[model samples]
Target: MGNHTEVTEFILVSFNGQPQMQIVFLLLFLLMYTITLVGNAGMILITSCDSQLNTPMYYFLKNLSFLDICYSSVITPKAMVSFATGDMAISYNGCATQMFFFSLFGTTEAFFLAVMAYDRFIAVCSPLLYHTIMSKKRCMCLVCISYFFGCVNCCTQTGFTFSLAFCGPTHVNHFFCDVPAVMKASCSDTFVNEMVLLVVCGLIIVTTAIIVLVSYIYIVTTILHIPSGKGRHKAFSTCTSHLMAVSLFFGTVFFMYAQPGAMSSPNQGKVVSIFYTVVIPMLNPIIYSLRNKEVKEALIRQLKRKGFETIMDNCSTASEFILVGFRDLPELQVTFFITFLVLYITTVMGNGGMIAVISADSQLHTPMYYFLKNLSFLDLCYSSAIAPKALVNFFEEKNIISYEGCVAQLMLFTIFVTTEGFLLAVMAYDRFMAICYPLLYPTKMSKKSCNRLVATSYACGCINGVIQTSVSFHLRFCNLSKINHFFCDVPAVMNAATTYTYLNEAVMFSLCNVIIAITTVVIFTSYTYILSTILKIQSAEGRRKAFSTCASHITAVTIFYGTVFFIYAQPAAMSSPAQSKIVSVFYTLVIPMLNPLIYSLRNKDVKAALKRTLGKKRLFSMNR
Candidate 1:
């Protein structure tokens, strides 16, 4: 291959063969880029403005958000333009600049996440010494060191990548000048470049990953000894969001670059890049805000100080909405109605019974049952929000919902669902404390703390509901008002919009996934520690009992999240309206009913409480 010194500029062949998809790409990228800016900017603003968030954890979070903004801007704006205009050309110097900054920020973010893991470990594993260990001076030193290392790493890789003679085609088969894509364009023997790339990038990734892994190993071990279940839960919750962010960020980067050869096709590489660059930046703020109660509370306080009415005024919209429940299936209408009616009745009986049992029984009045009571209440609300309307719509020729009605349903449904997610996570934490930190359960899960946790769950749910409902209805529906699903869901309603739904979809996708991912992380993390503790127990019976205690909640979580991910996380093109409705029924109706049964049947305390209540009723009847 001959070196072409005259080629002053390289063309970025981004989505070149598919001209039809360019507009879609342009709109999507533009929306994502805008959100990336707003979310990261908001994170930084809130952290700076709030005094409560002045801890080491948030200090790193602030920097991470800033890094996300910078790295995302490197590729997103240019990619959006490339999609909008046909001008995909980039000067040699321009490409090098982009490559340098991209590497700089990307490497910095990776190191930052690892540093965050260390911060969390210190906080969870050594709370008394955390302030001393991660002092302001040390934190600043760490941040500066991260950037210094990032600069050195970026310069080393960028210099080598660009130094290669680009004698071959100047058309880079990527949205931006990524290290691999640019290297592929070099005409020289690039074995040394690939080796340098593999060795250097591999070391950075592995070293950071090892730091995180080691930190969590200690963190989990420390959490397991917390005498109170609440204490263990609180310690674990602090790191859940960070773990989620790390998994997403490092997982994608590892897949993209951690290979001896080109890992995948260019198209696949571009898709992976899109996630880490465009999607992850927009997600960091949401992940942190949703998982961190302090951040959420800070946001609420800030909003209240600015006047709640202003926020409400901006969010208020949607006069009426017609729910296209189950489409036109008159033949199965009666069957569907009967099926839903039975399911609804069963849900009420099950969840209602659980609530009644927990409230009446003195023996069941623990932190665990306190959360269970909230869970039951949320299940009742969640079911009522969807099931009644669904059953009514099954018989009606036209499934119509007033605008206010739709908004109300959406709000109630979102609140309960979101609250339930957090409630389940809280329950998992409670179990972890009970099993792992049995000695501290009473003090850690006091009445005051339990009440606070329940209150926070509901508050977080309301906040999530308001944001999701507002965003969904804010879109101009035009004439397309008929929702495909049986109830008003964010995705279904967003899909009904006649205008470009990319932004709406992006927001909805990011929000739902963040919530789901955070909750999942908390649950899994709690269990990871719980399982470790269980294995160490000397008695098999004790281990069995501990496992049994978590069985009901785990089952309930699996059924609920499995259905949710199937409905929301899946690509819209692959799922039909009918498929969505069927899955929705399982979660909305069937799971609520099953939850009480799973708890009651498997739980010794619940069964004992039920027997006592039945015995008293029989004795009263005999006296009568």
Candidate 2:
């Protein structure tokens, strides 16, 4: 017998040789892992909660999502921990267990995709029989069968691979323990093991590929036969997402494992393995959710559901959260405090002055100014929400905030920030109307309409705030009480929680992305038409005047969006606590102070209004 005692555990290759590169790899994989978890879990939740998505296709999609979660979880967490701790040792049993689970989930995913393709084929080719053929019971049975076969295949592979005698070098070149990697370390002949791996893997991959290919062939044929162009387009649209997903998943997988091992370098294998393992799972939900209008509408409906609102309303939590502002820079606390205090004072004066000026001047009473006023008010509130506590925290030895205080801060922050986003979108729409159809501007943007828009912005902000804050605090937070960043943000709080936060992270990710995306689309679409209209203006003076009116708004939008995206759009894992704090300072403190200056300095109207008000005050004082 081959000497098994010599090899009790295996050492995985270090992610990278350099320390900084290792940190980068850790962050990248952590981001991918978080995305995979959130996306797959969101897919499952969306499918289960939305009854309209109760079809065999979504049913299969749900199972596929679950499989992706399990598959990614099998390898990603261990890899992440390995990177984090620089510990690559995997005991014999641990390696075997990882191999078994990996094989099971991976094989199941392949089979599930093939089954999904078949489902699409039947739906497209024989719509009448789709319901009968892919019934709930039948769907469950197919899913179970996929698991059954996956288990059998995994057990066989795991047993055979482990049964081999690993004698000399127990170092696995790959990140995870797989058949090929393990077999590479075996002292005895691995011919039988290699043959079995080749045959089993090839059979599974080839069979699934054939099924998918044949299904698409018939699906395309049926789609092409449709009489109407719209019908054909509609029919093809359903399959496009699936096809893309299949192409992504199978392409990387086939490229990774289908060919003989010697043809590809280990580095190539690692890159491809990441694509299939981390990237594909993250992309699948996005592809499906984006392409399918049904999913989008369902998401909207879910957002508007009364139950969602009720969940937020019922949240009663602790009083305060300690705003841990810049704890990393103990020596720079006084400097930071002075700097933030100056920013805070400037922000209050700028926003407060704008609000006063707008309120006093009947000349500035228009839809645009109305939106500006709301935005200024929002900035004032937004700055106040985080700035004071942050300033206070800089001086305090132990920055402790009450439980209720934390929740309130979060709620207020969410409300104001969300409101600001909507207000900016409204301002963009206002500009679009003024520039695109000057004749209809008066009728389209009536005072009542302006009031309604402002009201809607606040209403939506409150609702969003309620939901986000409720969901965030609802999580169990036994692990750490200290907030990492300046204020009580969702990601920071979610990180502090001890419980499984995949659902919370997924919900937050979806909410933030959806809101930001919708508002961004509105702003961009409005600007598109506005820009086109501006270009068509005949007179040079008229075009110059039109551009001048929008210049301030554009500048403000750029500053706001650039900072927000830089901070929030990035993966939280990539952002160090100190980096997050610095970024937060810019958006929350500096941007608010800068916004009023940008508008007032760029616009002649605001400056003239200020001058006229001052002149009136001077005349009144002289008469007195």
Candidate 3:
């Protein structure tokens, strides 16, 4: 800060280190932020959903989780941007706003933790009076008081800190606009401001810290007098998490603000600031989750309800498999993560857009769009089965999958892939009927028959998936099994087996041949007759129209078949694991991305349907 007329903004100088350190910290910050959000959000969800967590502890805990989210959000995101972009200037009002909310949430969290300590004190020290003392109305009032004090504490510190006259633009030495950093940057006399900040911070910290200390003291004293050791441990365990959380929050706030003058230099302050701001918020939920038996049981109950019961049902590692994905190519892992992330997003959006267009436009309710919708669904499932896991594995050190997870991934991927093949064959037959026998097309390919054909396609794929997964998973494997690809593939999984897998291999290979041959026969026969019929058309436009309909499907089929045949049918080339993994990615991820684009660009009906859908929206909006 200088002797200027008016200060406009502040430049944050924290985290502006060497490029290498910035990158490291950036990744760490991102991972911490993600955990903070997911963990806090999960605690919120568990408390809200689970009846077991209906006590005063969880009620305040839910609010504390939401407060942690708001607290971390106030600073971490902007710091992440500063790390990424290197433009760390924040406007004057923005700085004040950041200070206000950050202080508010921070102070509120302190008070909430204090309240939680008191709740545990009552639960353990006065079990009979717990309900009467911590009733709903009283709990609400306590929370409101926490917020009210948070507001007052924030206003006193933030207002007094900013009220000091700064002669020049402020340059904050920290990632965020903290009171200490702002005071350091001020040109005016900050003695009164610093005294006020320290005094205010001391009162809040001492007040809340005393509540936590006294509560735990009473809790421990009560537990010590219990006749049974188990009872003593059970009672103390309930306060353990709250005690740890209080130590972390109050310890940091006291260190940063309760000191007489500046606590430390800018660099040390920045490093310490990260703990309370980013790390503690993320750690609290995890600590609670691990320590609290009820929270764990509730999490398991929730998971089981969501269909993970199958995974949770088995405890053995007999079916576990590790995915060996991009482990050897360490240098290119980041590049691959970015590339596949983009491809996955594109695949989902493209296929989803096709489905939306088909459903919205009544003109697309014909047999072609119906089949197209099914194809898009298959493609979407295909990519989702592989890409999400594979993308995550790119950055992870050990790409482990449970036996149930591997089985499910392989099962779903097989189902989607096989169904697409059969669906494409059915699509060829639909095109053949449309071109070869236009008069009989609608009657022969009636709604009932079309439904039967699609269902039959799924039935074929499901049967094959069951057979494939059953055979592939049965073969014995090494103690530590590793599948040599991004996601599970039949060939990759089979190759990892330690036992005799000839029968498994034979069955898998034969099924692949049978699927390819059966679909190939249908598609080839239909397209052959349709080709002859199209050649005989008298008009060029008529021929072009017929070819356009089949072009997209043919392109999709050829690419998919070529990929499948190369990866699975030809076992000789499987020795080169790298090449096989590459093809597996193309087969699974790239095809989905291409399918919707192929249809939307090549088929007149899809484009027209999309346009009509958009035009309807525009007109509807104009009318409104």
CA shift of 435, model 2, Å: 56
The residue-by-residue lDDT of candidate 1 on 475-550, one tens digit each, is 5553326788888887788777544455456666776776676677668977998999999999999989889989
RMSD, each candidate, Å?
Answer: 21.2, 21.1, 22.4
Error of 2 at 408 (Å): 32
Give the TM-score comparing model 1 with the true structure, all chains together. 0.54
Candidate ordering by TM-score (highest first): 1, 2, 3
User: Which portions of model 3 miss their true places by more than 4 Å?
Assistant: 1-5, 17-20, 261-264, 304-624
Model 1: weakest 10-residue lDDT segment is 308-317
For residues 1-624, write the lDDT of model 2, one tens digit per residue. Answer: 557866778988745533323433554566556667766787888788888999999999899889888888888899878876789899988999999999999888888889999999999999999999999999999899889879988999998988888865578777888677777777778888878887888898999999999999999999989999999999899899989988998888777667776324776777677778777887788778755778755654565463432223333443445556677678988899899999999999998999888888899998888889889999999999988988888878789887778888989998998888878878887898898888988887888778867776786687568767877776655422678888898778876654455556667766667567656766897789888988899999989999888888888888887777765565663247777767778889988999899989877888888988889899999999
Cα lDDT of model 3 by residue, 31-62, tens digit: 56876886799799999998889889999999
User: Candidate 2, 410: how far from true, in Å?
Assistant: 22
TM-score of 2: 0.54
Tell me the deviation in Å of residue 260 in model 2. Answer: 0.7
Displacement of the residue 298 alpha carbon in candidate 2, Å: 2.2
Model 2 ranges off by over 4 Å: 261-264, 307-624
